[model samples]
Target: MATASETKATRRDFLYVATGAVGAVGVAGVAWPLIDQLNPDASVLALASIRFDIAPIVEGSSVTILWRGLPVFIRHRTEAEIEEARAVPMADLKDPQRDEDRVVEGHDQWLIMIANCTHLGCVPVGEAGDFDGWFCPCHGSHYDTSGRIRRGPAPANLVVPPYEFISDTVVQIG
Candidate 1:
């Protein structure tokens, strides 16, 4: 037989305990989403770096691959193509060749550039000898074989991304 005062005290204790439990659960529910947001899902597919085998790209041929979600152009130049690029005088080009014209160290034949046009971000199709370079059919922008702006509305040369030769047959573009 509990007294009235004892009954009230027990009820108050139980109420405090119930209130604390609900508060903890509510806090946990809110905190759970925040914790989940902070952690990356292990089941999600990771964006691994792509590697291109350059052996199949014969001299005078070009290959395009997606690198970091951008189209990257890898042009393997033949001796004649290299000569053609070198023969284009800087004064004749809309975007003249500076020391920055060359990207790779000690490799003059392998030209890597972003395939997007500098003007409107359109992908320029390589036309080989039509102009000895890329031709953007979108707006008639012409880029020389070295990716320099040769003609049209392109304000600058094609972008050159960082690249490295992993092996004789492999090139990594990032």
Candidate 2:
């Protein structure tokens, strides 16, 4: 089977495959930067995870901060507020969640939640509702002190963003 034409054809096929592979690699190299640039830049990335100090926040008072373009409520709950949240029966809640379940253990005094109301994404006013939690003026949604929907139109509890205490007074939220 020592045919010159067959040998030429085999060589031609090998060249075609090699050319195709090289072309594919070239195309990938050109496209990579275009794809990677679409990702979030440094400023956006910096906002993705932030460390907040809770030391300045007074007991029975709360502060609101922006995280990933969402308003987040960081509350230093008073003893009465904590007691009120814990005393409510699970049966009375529209979206029943235990008070302890919403907060990290050993950090009972601090309560954090995304301030947007679950009903229509409206910012709820804190410590002013029927349950003394949060009330969405847009839809009359009432959230309890534990951020559980106690009444009105909301179907779920206020969202709890991913967060942890990095130090005694510093909290890292993402």
Candidate 3:
């Protein structure tokens, strides 16, 4: 059997070990936010309005940008693609077009959408074909060129955030 002194020593050692473990966890918790702040591309800080030079986007091409920690899709639609989107019957769309759905006042060629699937928040890849839309491989959600939900399991249209055109070649997506 151990003496009283030995029993006291063992209890003290266990206490020290528990205290050290808690201290290490606390230090790590505090250090993680500091380390993340030091990262160059950290999004903890609020993003200011940014202007994108879109001259490189061809008439039929689309580009993706990270804005406020969300993927923004900016597609420069050709006249043919714009007509194709317009040709999609409202009866076929899950959410029929209203005047508010149109992003620009008088243009239907520039298609902008938040590149996130409405069902599960996955980024969808732009598939330019007969299924000319964004396809989410996660759960097979599909969005038309106008960001309207065409098929699959997504419940709503791809979001179109508040944005404005700074110029014919510059767009400010907030």
Candidate 4:
């Protein structure tokens, strides 16, 4: 019972609606993967932060923990080590960072640094370098007690990760 112009207009409206739906689907097909890729994978998301208990780490010893596929060193420095780090003049350092700057105000005994050697990503041996901090056996780089680069081929100091004390004996790192 519809007239000729009415039939043509209805067909045109249907075509427009159908075209819009298909275009939207096509756009979504292309955009979904890109949006999903921006999100972090499960393992990486898991490493976004880590909580550590410092109570069991005795003085003058270090513990290694995995964070974002890298080893992080948590050292409980002895009083002598703290004194030795503090005594070094700023001019002697390759990176020129003060010992107090590297540690928290109330808790100067805890030293936290990323465990890889800055020279070539090799793991450093704790308390073995010329500076009595960490030594990279692979390339002979030395780090001091404050994780400052002291000798050999490394261009910079060991990296310090973002961290905070959650409690007197607990620390959170990211």
lDDT of 2: 0.92
TM-scores, all candidates, are: 0.69, 0.86, 0.68, 0.82
> Residue 50 CA error for candidate 4 (Å)?
1.0
Give the whole-model CA lDDT for all candidates, comma-separated: 0.79, 0.92, 0.78, 0.92
Question: Model 1, residue 16: what's the lDDT?
Answer: 94
User: TM-score for model 4?
Assistant: 0.82
After superposition, candidate 1 runs with Cα above 4 Å error: 1-48, 98-100, 128-130
| Candidate 1, 91-170: lDDT as tens digits | 88787884235557666778888889999999998954256889888988987768888889999889888778888788
Q: Per-residue lDDT tens digits of candidate 4, residues 132-173?
A: 999999989989988999998989989988889999899999
> In what order do the candidates fall by TM-score, top score first?
2, 4, 1, 3
Each model's Cα RMSD: 7.8, 3.1, 10.5, 5.2
lDDT of 3 by residue, 120-165 (tens): 9999989642358788888887777777888888888888887788
Candidate 4 regions with alpha-carbon error over 4 angstroms: 1-30
Query: What's model 1's TM-score?
Result: 0.69
